[model samples]
Target: MGRHSRKGAEAIRPDAAAADPAGRPDVPRPSGGRRRRQGPVPPADGYTPFQDAPQVRGGHPEQREPGGGWGTGPQPRHETTGGQQRSYAYGSAPGAPDQDAAREQAVARQVSAQQAAQHAADGRTARQPAADPGAMPGPRREFVDAFDADPPTPVGTPEARSGAGAAGPPVEPEEAPDGEPAERREAKGGKGRTFTGIAAAAVTTVLAVVVAGQVAEDSAGRGAVARAAGVDRDGSEGASRSDARPTPEHAVTRAPEVKPLSYGEKMAQPYPIAADLKATGKFEAVPGLAKAPGKGQKYRYRIDVEKGLSLDAGLFAEAVQKTLNDDRSWAHNGAMTFERISSGSPDFVITLASPGTTGEWCAKSGLDTTIDNVSCDSAATDRVMINAYRWAQGSATFGPKLLLPYRQMLINHEVGHRLGYNHVSCRTPGALAPVMQQQTKSLDIDGIKCKPNPWVHPGS
Candidate 1:
């Protein structure tokens, strides 16, 4: 039979190597009189204790129960010597005393020398006091024992070196030739930095001044320059804030004064016209109004003139208003009032025209005023016509002596007809005639003669 054949007891389980890491198939278990269970044989080359054996990473052995039959061989290496312990990992072989111990002692000696030298240098410096002289730490334990195990995890790297070096004494500052600190010697370069800063500040100030001058020139413009040079827009210096202004009296212009005519002058100055001069049929109303002067049943009347009449229309208007509104006339004792208007439909239009125009207008209402060349109230229409010839000349009855009363009586007699009154006669002979009497042609009626009257209530 071939030597490689397995017995029934050799089950070739996955944990066979864990039961016996030595890979010695013929070796017996420590149990009494029983053949040892074998593990799979290992390759001759690249053989290691942990390969195919149940072990932890980093070359550490797994803990096994005491009831297992695998404790007879040498124990795999752990992190210790016969009586010493180490914090580093993965060193040379276990129990090899000479080279590993000698190398560790040399490393400890070199670290201790470096710490002693640093302590001596700290003592000689005057600027730095020795730190905690009583509790001064000895040579660092980490650096002294850094190489004792050489574990798979690295040690004494730059990070480990800094942590281990922190417990040591401080290094000394470099000294100047005069025993002053090297930092004091370095202050010579600070003077250059300060000079550079001052020069930059001066440049900044000069630039700021230049910018301000440009801004002022732009803001002031040519007008400000001209003012500062004492010159005006005409290039002359004559006008200034201190120049005197013209006086109020000389600066202002006064209108010429006019004197108004008295009542006598307006009534006496007559405008002459022919007794038979006909004109254009068109009429123009005077443009004004005189409001009633009393609280009574008011009658509004208008003044209209034939287009070519030569008499004073203003005088005629004034005469009619004064005669009617008088206390002795239609408005006596505020019984009634009369207002004259120039527009809209009035109660009556007192019109002045030539005798021919008067005849023409009166004929429209079927009246025969042409027989005596007198005036009439065209009652069916809006006009009460007065003869302009008689207005300009005095009648023979009233004469020039009472020319004003004759004019007033003429307006009243005709306008009274417009007020709904018929011709009335004076009952008393030689007394004032009733204003409704036909005083313009004659004052005689039924052989009774009356003086001229111009008012409804003459005594008032």
Candidate 2:
């Protein structure tokens, strides 16, 4: 501090003070006029001074001291955000302008205050003359957090605080979908963000797996369908001739190409087997039941038709039941009723089969029907085989005119053997032959010619 360190600015320049007419340091006068001060009389007491005592804050130019200059003083603290600035002066002397605390505080950065504080902290203990009680506060070091300072403005504003190089207008707080400030809508603890991230990851994973599965299916299906479809994915024809193939899901499905049958070709029109016909040995039993309607000992039987036979299996089954129970057949007087069955144990299986199939089954019983191409009872197995060839084509003895009776006699003879009857001949000449007779070969045995009969008791 100089000689005016405790006072306001030296308002009257040094020359003016020195050239006073009264020759006093306090009073002054003009050259051509009576000794007087500029515009105002000096007070009885000196004007209040702007203090600049060593190691102490300066004070305002309260009123005015004789010759006080700028120093420092107690300043009101101000805070700002985003770097805005303003300035003003308070408690300034009437005729003297000195450092103002308001102006000091309005500065955006307190660089001077920081330097002053640093000097104080470094133990610069040089003391100056005592300051007036009405002057600035006592000098002391202040330690604070080395926090960064910002000017006053809304957060995230686009404008530069210095008003230079601002690209656009300042930004205001954004509103959320619910109309609240976006900042408020944000999750402070990160819980919302965490949940959102997890959901996104899960969705992504699910989509990836689904896409992968579909890709795998398409890849696997492509080649298999190509050969069948004979069409390629690359718009070419034929699988072996093309590089890419269509997916199986897109492969065309075609119904079997079967020629429709006419009345002559339908199963209703029975087809004849060659005299030398042989067939698959597999058989299918006729399905369902026929109750034993008469009162007598009942016997359940199944009707089986060999596979590949061009004959009506139902007709064969129905004929067996109807013929056996006929008054002229073995079921005469209902000595034993016959029940047709598909399931459960049966007394026997009456099989209508091709000549070859019939021969194989008959051989199981040590019976030979191939010599005459006749039907036989395969007593060794569950089947009583009727030669389908013979069943379809009447014997030469009966001829086609007697075809029905011939078929009836065939069933009666074979099944009769299964009923514990042996072959017999007609005793009385011109009488009906025994049902057990081998009529398929010759109705007249040993020249004892007899009428054809298909009954246990010829009269009954």
Q: Write the per-residue lDDT of candidate 1 for residues 326-366, one digit (tens) a residue.
A: 88877888988899898888988889988888898899999
Task: Give the per-residue lDDT digits (tens) of candidate 2, residues 343-422.
Answer: 98998899988999888888988988899988888888988888898888878877766777777788888888888889
TM-score for candidate 1, residues paired by index: 0.43
TM-score of every candidate relative to the true structure = 0.43, 0.41
| Candidate 2 lDDT (Cα, 0 to 1) | 0.60
Which regions of candidate 1 deviate over 4 angstroms?
A: 1-260
Local lDDT at 405 for model 1:
78
Give the candidate number with the greatest lDDT. 1
Off by over 4 Å in 2: 1-271
RMSD of 2: 24.9
Residue range with the least summed lDDT across 10 consecutive positions in model 2: 79-88
lDDT of 1: 0.63
